[model samples]
Target chain A: MDNFSFQNPTKLIFGEGQIAKIANEIPKDKKVLVIYGGGSIKRNGVYEQISAALEGHQWSEFSGIEPNPSFHTALKAVEQIKAEGVEYLLAVGGGSVADATKFIAAAACFDGDPWSILSEGARIRAALPLAVVLTLPATGSESNPNGVMTNYETQEKLAFYGRQLFPKFAVLDPTLTYSLPAKQVANGIVDAYVHTVEQYLTYPVGADLQDRFAEGILRTLVDNGPKALSEPKNYTVRANVMLSATMALNGLIGSGVPQDWATHFIGHELTALHGLDHGQTLAVILPAVMAEKREQKHEKLLQYAKEVWNISSGTESDRIDRAIDETRAFFESLGIATRLSDYGVTEQDIPAMIAALSEHKMTALGEHGDITPEVSAAILKRCL
Target chain B: MDNFSFQNPTKLIFGEGQIAKIANEIPKDKKVLVIYGGGSIKRNGVYEQISAALEGHQWSEFSGIEPNPSFHTALKAVEQIKAEGVEYLLAVGGGSVADATKFIAAAACFDGDPWSILSEGARIRAALPLAVVLTLPATGSESNPNGVMTNYETQEKLAFYGRQLFPKFAVLDPTLTYSLPAKQVANGIVDAYVHTVEQYLTYPVGADLQDRFAEGILRTLVDNGPKALSEPKNYTVRANVMLSATMALNGLIGSGVPQDWATHFIGHELTALHGLDHGQTLAVILPAVMAEKREQKHEKLLQYAKEVWNISSGTESDRIDRAIDETRAFFESLGIATRLSDYGVTEQDIPAMIAALSEHKMTALGEHGDITPEVSAAILKRCL
Candidate 1:
């Protein structure tokens, strides 16, 4: 296995009525900014629970952090935080709000233009301590030190990572997910499944234990995800999905191994240009990326075929084909479209996406670092 | 799943030559106390590597922490640490040294008699920061907050847990295990396997994902352990075992689940009384414990049978029996004796061991709060 240093200090408070724990987790003396998206929390009673939990704490609310968590919208929250001298941030909605709050937390402490942090991918030195009341189980932004931010003007989305911004505490109540729309639930499952695959389907670096753990999370998602969609009120299914999403990308599976995040990097362009949901874009791109990178990731693909998809008894090429097909099938099973055309994207948008990828001098994508811009275009063409 | 809060903050630095990186992990300004067992490290070049890494650091060495880590021996190290005003501790050997250093770190800052902290099971309020260069893969003391300390005077061993005493860092190099004896390697595998089983093999409790993770760790240990023993220098096998041991008991598998550590608690008594190795005692006790608690833990036993041993085509009773038998056989395959008679323990020791367990009043020994003292004694009798 490769050399690695790992430390995640996020304290996860999980189960029913955990939202009431907010008052104890955060200091009452600090000025807190509770961030959210739209007014879903109000209709779902999460807002009332959070407010009752806040009690005498010095806090205010910042609403309307959009679905994709755009830099343009997050900067407004940062401005309010700076103006109010907020010392802590509590994100109380879905992954988008949590992801935006992460940017707001960093931007509140950053000296330069906040947009530069995303565009230039600058190292973050310090940020206001952030906590979350996670009502959504996608993105894993609650426990991990990663957040994807979009620039609306440039029509671009990018990810930023720093050790300073991991949540101090996250309260996950699976029952809070009972009120979520079915589409959002399906999107969360697909998002979490792809997260596990992105970490696991790459070449194995003799990290057998980590590989098994990655596969375990993958299998759990596939087996339990359909049940979660049908029975939204099933506490066990929601709890399993919540835990699986947290474990999927919380730096546990990626330890001591090379990671191929090219699918995510490519999918961001689809979200940026076509305005597709983040999880839906991944459903469109992952299978095509796997098919294109099959030669380099052949052995791991075969293993994934047998272990995750149960596609044994085939030649290597046939196994890779079946594995990619199984992946697309799994996403489709979640009611997510696996083709760009299925989502109403035309062939006209493909050239612009390809140009954006090539403009970045995209030459390395998979585990072997060999996915070029032409190969990316080929993958996208297959998706079309 | 049950309500749970989980957090582990130990920074794991894993790979070859990671010991050299210890200089940067610890604070140079703090007065450090280096603790270890016998002089095996000195003969194996680990001591030299640590010495070189200690350049320009204020540090002192306290050697001779024995196996099982007695309170009598740990008191001496505590005294020296207090005299030197040590601000941090560095444990450089196996789990015994690391476990001993945890007590030393707590006891140095503790008021009143240090043994009171163990005997009274009082909450530890503060402790000096501790780090480790783990040369053993058996007990997961390097990454967890729990430690077992023996009272040599009473022939008693007890476990104490405190949140304040987790290690600040742990350096794990699988290459460090290459020179270990064959018996130590076998013991390490059994120790890790039992750790996983203790957390698993309980009632399902809606923790399907945790069950899968626990089973994955068990499968990895069974698959890679023999390869590690036969080819001692095989990096992949050693790395897999090291990572498996860490994942097995680092609170990852136990979260949101009912854990039955009755076998570990009982195994400690056999070790303290008979001078048998901790892992060997566990091998002897676990199968008998399974047999004794089969009725209460029937559902989980069937799950374990189907998942780990793959005995699906049998009656429930037959499957439980086969699973228990297979567990004993796996331990024997590691060259461990799975019966008390194989270790030369006679019938006279059984009543005294039962008395010790009764004194502790461990009423809730198994998953369903079963495994009374009488049941524990019956399990011991079966082992004989």
Candidate 2:
């Protein structure tokens, strides 16, 4: 295995009625800003539970952070946080709100323009400490130090990272997810599965423990996804899904290995251009990316086939093909469309996407760093 | 699933030539105490690497912490640390030295008799910060908050736990184990395997991800043990074994699960009474414990059979028996004895071990809390 240093200090408070822990987790003296998206917490009783938990705390609320967590909305929250002298942030909704809260936390302490951090990918110095009441199980923003922020004017989305942005604590009560719409549940499952695949299906770097962990998360998502959709109120299904999401991108699978986030890098463009949901865009791009990089990722493809998809008794090429087919099938099983045309994208958009990728000088995409702009275009065309 | 709060803040610096990073990991201003066991590190060249790394630091060395890490030895280290005003500790040998450093770090800060903390098992208020340069791949003291310390004077062994004693960082270079004696390697393999099984083969606790992770570590140990034994110079095999040891007791496997460490507790007595190695004691005791608790641990044993040992075609009883037998065989394959008699322990030692276990009043010995003292004694007899 390649040399690596790993450390994640996020304290995970999981199980029923864990939302009440938000008050105790954050210090009593710190002024708090609770961030949410579209006020879903109000309808789901999460808002009431959080309010009751923080009965005496000096706090305020910032609502209506959008699904993709745009820079503009997060800047407004940062303004409110500065105005209120907020020392801590509590994100109470989905990954979007959690991601936005992270941005707001960093922006509150940043000296210059907050957008500069997103555009230039600046290092974060200090940030208001943040905690989360995680009602959504996608993105794993609660435990990881990564945030994907979008710019509406530029039609661009990009990721920024800093160790200081990890949540001080996250309260994940699966019971709070009982009211989630079936589409969101399916999206969460697909997002988590793709997350594991992006980390696992690159190349075998002799990281056996990480490979097994990634496969374990994928297996859990596949085994438990259908049940979660059909029985939304089932605590076991929600618990399993919640745990799977946390494990998928908590920096566990990606340690000591090369990660092919080429699918995610491409998926972000689809989300930026077509306004597709993040998870849905991944469903559209992952198989195509796998097919494009099959030669470089052959051994891992065979391992993924044998361990995850159970596609043994095949030649290397056959195993890779079957693994890619099985991946697309798994996403389809989650009711996600795996083709660009299914989302109403025309052939003309392919050129613009390729141009956008090339403008970023995005060569060396896969584990071997060979997915140049030309290869990216071919992958997108294959998706079409 | 259970309501749980999980956090591990230990920074793991892993892989080839990581010992050089030790200088940057520790604070420059703090007075440091470097602790070690015997002089094996000098022979292995780890001492020169550590001495070169400690060039600019205010550090002192305390050697001679023996196997199992007795409190008697730790007290001397504690006194020296107090006299020298040591602010931080760097444990530079195997688990024994690291475990001893944990106790010393805690005891140096406490005002009362140091042994009271071990005998009475009280919560520790504070501890000097500690880090590790792990030369051994066994006890997992590098990444965990628990440590076992023995009292040679009284012939007693006990485990003490305090979150404050968790290492701030651990440098794990698998290359450090290349020169270890064959006996040490065999003991390390058995110790790591039993650690995984202790958390796994109990009852199904709905911790699907944790179970998979535990089984993954077990499979890695089994797959890599013989190679590590035969090809001691193979970097990949040593790296895999080293990583398995860290993963085994890093609290990842016990999350949201009911863990049965009854084997470790029973095994410790055998080690204390008969002067056997910790891993050897475990190898002899675990199969007997499994046999005694087979009815209570039925479902998980069948699951272990199917997933880990691949013994699927059988009745429930047959599968459980086969799983237990396979576990014993795996330990024997590591060159460990599966019965107490194989190590020359007579019948007289059995009653003393039973008395030690009874004094601890560990009635709930298995997953269902059904292994009473009588059951434990019966299991011991089975081992004989």
- Chain B TM-score for each model? 0.95, 0.96
Compared with the true structure, what per-residue lDDT tens digits does model 1 show for residues B1-384? 999999898889999999999999888899988898988999889999999999999999999998778898888888788788889999988888988999988888887787887888877988889998999898888999988898878866777888887899999999998999989989989999999999988777878789889988988888888888889999989999998998888888899898888998788678766879888988999999888888778899998898788789868999999999988988888888898899898787898888877777765687777788888888899999
Docking class of 2: high
Worst 10 residues of 1 chain A by lDDT: A359-368
Q: Residue B340 in candidate 1 has what lDDT? A: 89
Off by over 4 Å in 2: none
Clashes of each: 0, 0
**DockQ per candidate:** 0.86, 0.85
After best superposition, candidate 1 residue A335: deviation in angstroms?
A: 0.8
> Native-contact recovery for every candidate?
0.89, 0.85
Worst 10 residues of 1 chain B by lDDT: B360-369
Model 2 earns a TM-score of 0.97
Candidate 1 error regions (>4 Å): A314-317, A346-348
List per-prediction Cα lDDT, in the order shown: 0.87, 0.87
Residue pairs with backbone overlap in model 1: none
